[model samples]
Target: MKRLYHWPLDPAGRLVRLALGERGEAFETLESPPWSPHPDISRLAHGAVAPAIVDLKTEPRMFACGTRAICEHLAETGDGTALLPESAADRAEARRLWAWVEAACEEVTDTLLTERVMQWVRRDRQPDSARLRRGAHALRGRLTFMNGMVEINGYLAGRQVSLADLAAAAHLSAYDYFGDVEWDAVPDLKEWYARLKSRPSFRPLLADRLKAVRPVAHYADLDF
Candidate 1:
């Protein structure tokens, strides 16, 4: 069986899981926290990243990491739900949107997570409140920009849902758990997000619990 090394709380990992489930592919799941330096994951992969995959039947079990690359690989290696569009133009557009989402998540989303949510996960010195504040501010700015992009006929990557939806929703869902997202400020995005969150694959993500974290009722509420 194909194996996926991952963390339940990770936005990037969640993106991969959502794609995998949406495509109806089967794989084993492992919880590997990104910040941990211990000897975790498998020796075959030679990496401890939350999205590293291994195909046991292969000589070199290591497959790939990173959200977009793995999603494309899975879509190619399986049946149903063709994630990568067939046309060169559509593929280029998909990749472009994927790249933008990755940059935004790393530069904005993960910064907020490391401060607000992931702080409790580590036995670190302290959570940088100033950086958290900065990330919160950055998130508002990015949300404003993204909300505008999404307003033009819906979905972040364009008309049809694509990796862009998975990427954006994963980050927003993580922040939502921390009460970081001001949903009213972006009602269109919020409505779209509510639909995404209601999907079967996403319920696991919404239901996942972490100590000291209490998600709002609206987190699981399909409406609003």
Candidate 2:
């Protein structure tokens, strides 16, 4: 058995989950919010962050932290379709876009998603309008760029699904959970997302729900 510590809404966590799910690997999930991680996380040297994984099946055990470490480990060990492309050039392009998605979405997550989580989950503050606006503005720019890429290449890195597509979808899915993504504004990207949403690996994320917060109606709708 393998165990995963993650926050449902964290894009990095979602990326790991997607990779694991795509590989058809079963893992027991333990929720670990960034503000207050699971106590067991302190025991593993490389499991300090959410999205960490521990392979209980291994004799000496194996642990990995963060998206890069976890996803790469799974890609290497699992007997499923590779998340990274086979061609060297395509693999490099996928890695580049994977890094780019995280960098680009950092602002949106720090602002919009953080504010939403603070306001609803923490329930200790009001939503910051200024931060929300800033996040939305940044999100629009990212969506536009992604839309162009999908329009030209069918997927972020190429015709086949790759880490780039999964990474971008993970980030965008988090935003979409809050109804923050303006799908109409980026038609090509929206179409691409619909295809991703229909995947079996994406079902668990669509079903995620916070205690006091409800997702938007279209969050789980594959057609939307």
Scored by lDDT, the top model is: 2
List the candidates' TM-scores in order. 0.88, 0.97
By how many angstroms RMSD does model 1 differ from the true structure?
2.3
Give the Cα error of residue 200 in candidate 2, in Å: 0.5
lDDT of the candidates, in the order given: 0.75, 0.91
Q: Which segments of model 1 are wrong by more than 4 Å?
A: 37-42, 45-48, 57-62, 123-125
What candidate 2 gets wrong by more than 4 Å, as runs, is: none
Error of 1 at 80 (Å): 2.6
lDDT of 1 at 122: 62
* Residue 92 in candidate 2, Cα distance off native in Å: 0.3
Q: What is the C-alpha RMSD of each candidate to the true structure, in Å?
A: 2.3, 1.1
Clashes of each: 0, 0
